[model samples]
Target chain A: MNKLPDALPVEKAAISDLARQTLHGTVDEATNARGRERMISAARAGASKSNGTQRRRRITRASVLLFAAAALAVSLVIWWPRAPLTFVTTGGEVTSTHDGGVRVATRDAESVTRFSDGSVVTFGVQSAGRLEGVRTNGARVVLTSGELHLDITHRKDTAWSIEAGPYVVRVTGTAFDVAWSPSEGAFVVAMRQGSVVVEGPLTPAGVSLRAGQHLVVARDGVMRMGEGTPPTLAELAVASSDAVALVSSAAPVVVSRAPSAPAEAPPSSSVPAIATSVAPSDRPASFAKLVAEGRYAQVVTAARGRGLEWVAESASLEELVALADAARYEKDGTLARAALEAERKRFATTQAGRNATFLLGRLAEDSDGNTARAIVLYDEYLQTGGPFSAEALGRKMLAVRKTRGDAGAEPIARAYLEKYPKGVYAAAARSIVGTP
Target chain B: MPLTVAARKVVPVVRWQTPAELVQALLAAEPEAHGVLWDRYSTSLRAVLRRSLGPDTEVEDALQEVFIRFFRALPTLREPAALGSFLFGIAVHVARGLLRKRRIRRWFRLTDDGEIPEPPDDVDPVSEQAQAAVRRLYVILDDLDDESRLVFVLRHIEGLEITELAACLKMSPATVKRRLARVTPLVFARARNDADLASFMAAPDQGERS
Candidate 1:
């Protein structure tokens, strides 16, 4: 036993004999024969292992290169550019073609379209259209038939244009409604913002419609301006849905640019001249004209029929409101309700929306004897700054008192009196609230 | 009672040949050359493997790997006459490679297929004690880095000179000396903590600071 320095006592040579014995298990002679056989076998195994490693390296390198190439190919497919036509599908089939023309057919269903430039177009039943010349800054389509509600997102750099039978309605951006009825030989464009300019082959002079305006033209190129100003919010109190929209004969929709009425409202915008394209035979008897001629039953009959719905869809706001009265007079509660509902749904934020809602309330109360419905509609109209807010509030309180009594209506009666001191229902409001 | 002499009397392999002729015969992969090299180097290679590794059954496999590598590389040898270093080079590489693998297995808390192999039953008491001390020293030395252990084993136990150890390990002489300096204190400290090896280490009390 000895103390080791800088190393252990387990010296290499000291353990040499033992290790060899332990590993070999024998120190016999004939060792030469044994060693030669083992060495030959081991050498063979080593050669195999080295070859296997080199083959594996080659395989791994090939696989990595293949994977990178595939990824790049997939990247190229996703980013390929300059699409001819972008397909949009709603509830119906979309046919995408190479000619930049996509026809949306809604035979029995509705088709909703999302334009590339951030606009949404919804086609009504039996409506179809072909969008052509699609561009980055605008959507251009030729609507064939039926109705389409459009909402163009606010892109000052873009515009939306739709060619219905005889007229093309063009707008920079706006929420609007359009309809084309060949049976009625009529085309109508209604919009609330982003001035629309209507002109077509039949219209040589294009008409620029400001917000709240509607331009109606017949295939005869006879254009009539329906004083059809839709209701702006401030005008709700005085503007009835039945208020007369100015009647003016507009230029026909034939020429490419049909000479336009001034782009701005000129003070004396000519004696509202009848643009020469107005052909009497090409226009159907309009709803307003039918009503003016006191054909109430005919108006209601047309409003309820499928053939005339396309015409009714293009009815001026005043004509639609008047149609409800005619339907009520004919005792067609369903027809009248449908007429008013259409106006309310289409112009829910406008003065016409308030007017239609208030009248529906009156019809429900008086004609249908549904006081509860009448009360609710009056409250809704009043809340929307109803043109007849003072009246609507008064009617609400009266309806409440008549049905539920003073216990539930004292506050509403007070609200009416407070808003309209000398209103038509002021006397009754005062009585309900116990004021002099 | 020397093992070599006793084994020689029992049996003999091919007669030894001149160094130059032996290298030529070895490169030619002659069975006789293989037998002679085996007879000459197996004992030293086993000792080197066992010291660098530990007393284990794997040492036999490592011994086989060294011989396999040596024969396979015989033709590549620029100076086959210098087979001593070439053979030792194979032994060093195989042994170190096994030690690294064992270190990794321990790091991942892996064990051999089953329980450890039991020592031989015929071992004498003194020889068993010596084997235990050697095993204990290695168990602790495993904690030292591989290069440090190489310097310690070659310099002290194997008795290789600094320059020779450098050449064997493929480092400069200065590097080997620097490694030796670093390993001395570390080997000392760990050896002190190992119950089986503490007795063989000098300055047991000062082991902690060494």
Candidate 2:
């Protein structure tokens, strides 16, 4: 009854080969043995319902031992210690590492501790803190005295926090500066990019600080919270010796504290900014190469230096696409839009150019918050029959819902569900349609 | 010199030649038939599960579930000669259930430790490029619906024939073809668009049907 040809067409065969090579692999003998044992035990247990008590007893005996083994394995996995942070001190002395805790005291120069996830902590001269714990996702730091600068990398499920005296600053991936004096009971936190929550005395409920915000509590229980100016590139260069290049991409922020203003310096001097349009460039010949090397910040800086519009006009199609990617990564929406528009203008008929409309739609919805414009772009992209059609439709539906309410989005949701019943947004569409 | 019948001694060995015979033996509670069934199809089923699940550590558990389910449903299997297809149907069902569970877990912000599949040491290590392609492919698949994802993997990765795919997915051959036609080009286009997988996938123009 198999009437179709055995040989897949050349293209299909090639894809078939690629997928096969990419995915298929051998299951090890040990896993196979374990599976076989489990299968037999489970099957026997099921069969023992009809069989005599002897088989039931045998199954029970085997199951108990299996349960014990599984328990031990799970315990071992749970209690395993994550790898510690590898660090380097620049011309300073640090305490000997014990277990997972290390006291860091910078005497003559600053010390930098780097996490595996690309987060960096730089302790300024005369600063002291102990590494309370380090997990795969984050670390717990206790700042006893002096200043501590954190350029924590943002990642999914990151959990890093800083404790000073009675105050604790919870961080979910952001660059910030914090200073604490145990004797004086003074604490300061300055946010550069992402948001953070600070919990401490007086206001025990915790205060949330966004980018460019600052918080300070004095030794005498006086607190002053206000807007802070981000520091200039020149100030950051003078503040930390070698970290200038690392943090140059950030625009510095400064906040003032009343009681500790004279005794302690503002934490803004060490704040690491996320995306300063101005940064040092490696002068790569192509933006794609820079992106491949993971230097997104530099790509934006170089693109901006060349004039975003100029780069969009003169750069190669590939380079323009790469520039857009870099700008997107750097959270520079204007540059990203410019680059994408350039692709649509120059290589209008090319595959990359056609895909640009979808990316532009995403940018419009996410960064620009132009939901109506986003829907238009999504419609345009969908009409092109591009590869991202499903995603575009999904985004357009959401944008419609945002603008015209759920009732307005229902038709689009129905169309989306019809076209892509198992698409990424299927569940959301189902909810919109009130389907189970 | 040839030995005469009087001087020759023979030992006899018995084996089940067909899946129907194997099924009958299994139904008769012959213990050895279970091993025979596993020995016949486990490797193929394991590879299918591996592709569908994407290097998850729960593959072994899923594999056991397939066998146990197959055993329980053996009597209900109308076409006992089509045992491989029945087993595959169960495997896909189990993989879909696991994917649904994973989605729910993600919604609840729970980490799936079972999702991290252990690297195989027995096989020669894959090149970094191939590994990247694998990751990119799976990420794209994750965006598709469960049925489309399974169909793509079963048809393309597992190299199942259209008939076999229809049997496994419990869809008509026409429906299978339609779904494949819709999804295959889109997936290939996306793969071609991706930087890492672009080199691995055939160029769109080169592979396009004239």
Candidate 3:
């Protein structure tokens, strides 16, 4: 092979010598040592692999034996019988039964039972309940009358149940209020936080309830599930407290009333200030108040209670933006996008409308992973010179880099650096341009 | 030919004067032969890798791969004296594979289209300007197909003759000359158009050492 000497062709010499000079780096002694060590390690690995067949066979046999031993040990630990959890009651009288059960009866005051697993069950005044059985994992309680508030600590092995008349509420880890009237045959469950599954005679398959939900079953098999925060107890006591109803006061769909059982009805007057349903005349202030209070989940639920898409379309501009912000905080990307699009449509050429375009771009890029659409929307918003111009420009440059590579994004990056030299994306822009 | 060495570490102070001697020692599994082999050819191999895969790319990994392939294919080598050529062929093959993978990765925007490394603090200002021009030249080369890019790199940056490129690339001499002829003007045109490289292109002597 001929070594092309200095008599090389002019075209070859132009870039050739320049590239050679630029890449003229030498491997130092430390680098050579590292390379030698890597090769030696690789050589040792290859040599060991020559006898890998027998070694692998031995490993396989040992692994099987070890796995079998481990499985047996795990089985022994799992199937072993454990002692049941015990508890003591306070502020009430408990009558112990022969079958390791206790009956909690409160005459003039409430009763609070503390369990070993960090669970608390508060029985209301004049209430009667029974702990039928207690086990290592959980216990079963039957509320004969009045109300009971439960705050069950979350554990992986938890299993608790509360039976109110024919309805059985199963709980793993949650807090809720349950009331039952034997004579009235009415049951009500209002979830404060977490979730529970209720199985009943009306519908045997059971209905699941999440936080911020109220369920009531009348004697005539009429079921009503409403969207509102349940009534809060001032002291978890029946004395000095009014009847707190769980039904929504705004649009309470009362199909049938079972003879006005005051003890079983969660009063509307005691509803927490945040969960209070404002009258229809006060809804505009209610929307703003709900957003200011950071009740995003309640806002989403209330918006959906009314036709959400309709509210997005015909609601006032402020209401629409509030709904969009609420849905975004709630992580309901679809609803957030809908409200943003509606804001842009109804209030086009306004500052909020232009700002909606930038938010929609964020949703498109982050939530929907549509880089091309995000770039288009960002470009539209950038053309408007809106409040989010800097942020939108930075996002657009990154989105372009994601889809079109550094070469495609360099012009935008350069523009961004020129305008905002000390901006947030300055470091990233310098990286793309290979500048300091 | 069942060649086997006894299970013992052989760390001999053997100086391999020729490729034939190194290959013989390596085949015999002399542990010291690997280091000696690396000492003899590592510098040129590094240069070749740096030039072919750009300076910012993983040249160390490619260099290790070249030696590993050489070790793996040593048994099949028919002529011991042609070790250098055999290794060069393997380096070209590895470089071609990386170039193809790099193209696919670039299409997916998975990798940056390589940047010019920072010049040393002691580098002259003129050399720094040339480095920027080199960066632009690499960006243009990134647009070429893998085979064409390899042909250009081997012929020009590596200073290989047409016949040597043909041998290294497993192409005919006419094909090498044809690719070189086709790629030269295209590269020069791109360099002339590039603002950073125009100065280097206008005076070509601007890149020369004093």
Candidate 4:
């Protein structure tokens, strides 16, 4: 960690908290206002005394001696080490300093130092460059030296972006730092705000960065996005597989597992247009249309054609069977059972298929009240690398509990808590287990 | 020429002092001079303080300290109109000092009666939970250092200006600009993470049989 200069002992946490408290009305106003009034008045009076004499003297003494003497005094004052510059902020004060650093303080607010190699920094309240708002959205400082500091207050849902060097920082509304090192020929972006995506170099295209995350771009344009612990092998594997599965299920067809092929394959032609237009209201209408038209063959064909693929829509196997039965006016229990078994088999083979199976299981529970069968389907969906692993486990626990009462719920919840401590629905499981 | 010289001689040396100079004089035992000085720059100073301290804090207390400190350090000040900057500086110090004291008290869990409890250094279950919470919070705040955070809070939260901030802190305007550049994104990252967390938690479960 980099240590700040000793003169600047104020912690950022303390400052932020103070700012928050002051904004929230926890600080007193009347007394501070009066005190400020007195201080400024005194300073101005003194200024008039010093500058006033020079003005009056100039008027009286057109004489060379007095004129020369006045000019000399002015020069001396300007050259003086302690010559003060007027600092102002609408509601805060400039506080602390570091080598090549400064702050602007005003009542209830302060603007700290931002770096600029050769660029200018600008600030305005509310609207960008609209100095009228009581509070500023964020300050924009142009970087000339390839580095600038921007500390902004978080406005709900409002984001501030910084364009520095070859990078653009999309802020989520918190305080963070960005530095562009000309010597290194790369920009280093750090979050002070919530988080930011340091997009630049256009090499690998867009990159998303989170809080406590930093990235370094080499002069050769190689960008590595971490300084501390790099992504673990397990994490990378999970992310890769999840991405592949999610894309395969959402897209029309499952692209081959070819290493040379791009992660996102071109859309497949066989995937029906219905998958593309899978909206909430459209789900029931499409299902009804399929049933009315006796399109069981087409539904099964479509489902089979997109083998080992995930469909984000509600056109699962169970929904197809319901549509077929509604159209044919016949309930074939053997066919229904066969279709479900086939769906389960397909789901077990791939992550996307598993997600589809889970969706089908959920549809069955909703439409057919087959709780026992749904529980079995959910268990298969919870296998390793299952797309709905967390959801499947949660539903299984709920199903068992409902059938066997509270006694059965506790053990399932405990088992879930033990297996996946940070799993989705872990909190609910913990609640069931009576643990915090 | 003679009349001009006479006028110059009679003008009683025309001792004009800058606001800063008058402030210094008032602080240096000339309490009587303080009133005149106060009458001149009180409103401007108050505006600066109100903006700096924000409308939320006891602005009056901070303002009072500005005056007291102004008086106490008047002798050391060489420039007078820089009085605005000087007073602004004093205000910043006072605010930071108060905040530091508050943080220290909170960190130590100090009691109102001035008793300090033993700092919890052990990693017990309760402490571990607390540490985890603290860790998460810091993970949110860690992207920023102290200076960047202050700059962010003062400008964005308190809404201060480059010129005023530069004057108060006795720094160049450029420095404030650079600091702000670095601080904005850190704030944004934390907010984004929060939204993501909320969405993830709200996702519907597929296994739920209702």
Quote the lDDT for A8 in model 2.
Answer: 37
lDDT for predicted candidate 2 compared with the true structure: 0.68
Greater-DockQ candidate between 2 and 3? 3
Give DockQ per model, in order: 0.07, 0.14, 0.20, 0.04
Which candidate, 1 or 3, would have the higher DockQ against the true structure? 3
Residue-pair clash count for candidate 4: 144
State TM-scores per candidate. Answer: 0.42, 0.35, 0.37, 0.23
RMSD of each predicted structure: 21.4, 28.1, 24.4, 36.3
lDDT of 1 by residue, A26-134 (tens): 3334654455467656655545665676688889898898999998888887665635335466676678746666678787888888866568888878777766667
On lDDT, the leading prediction is 3
Interface Cα root-mean-square deviation for all models: 9.4, 6.1, 4.1, 14.4
Report, for every candidate in turn, its global Cα lDDT versus the true structure. 0.61, 0.68, 0.71, 0.46
lDDT of 1: 0.61
lDDT for position A69 in model 3: 98
Docking class of 3: incorrect
Q: Which stretches of candidate 3 lie over 4 Å from their true place?
A: A1-11, A50-436, B1-14, B112-126, B206-210
Full candidate order by TM-score, most accurate first: 1, 3, 2, 4
Please tell me which predicted candidate would have the highest DockQ against the true structure. 3
User: Across residues A14-94, which tens digit of lDDT does each residue of candidate 3 receive?
Assistant: 667788767753565677778767776665565455357558989999999999999999998988887887788887789
Judging by DockQ, tell me the better candidate of 2 and 4.
2
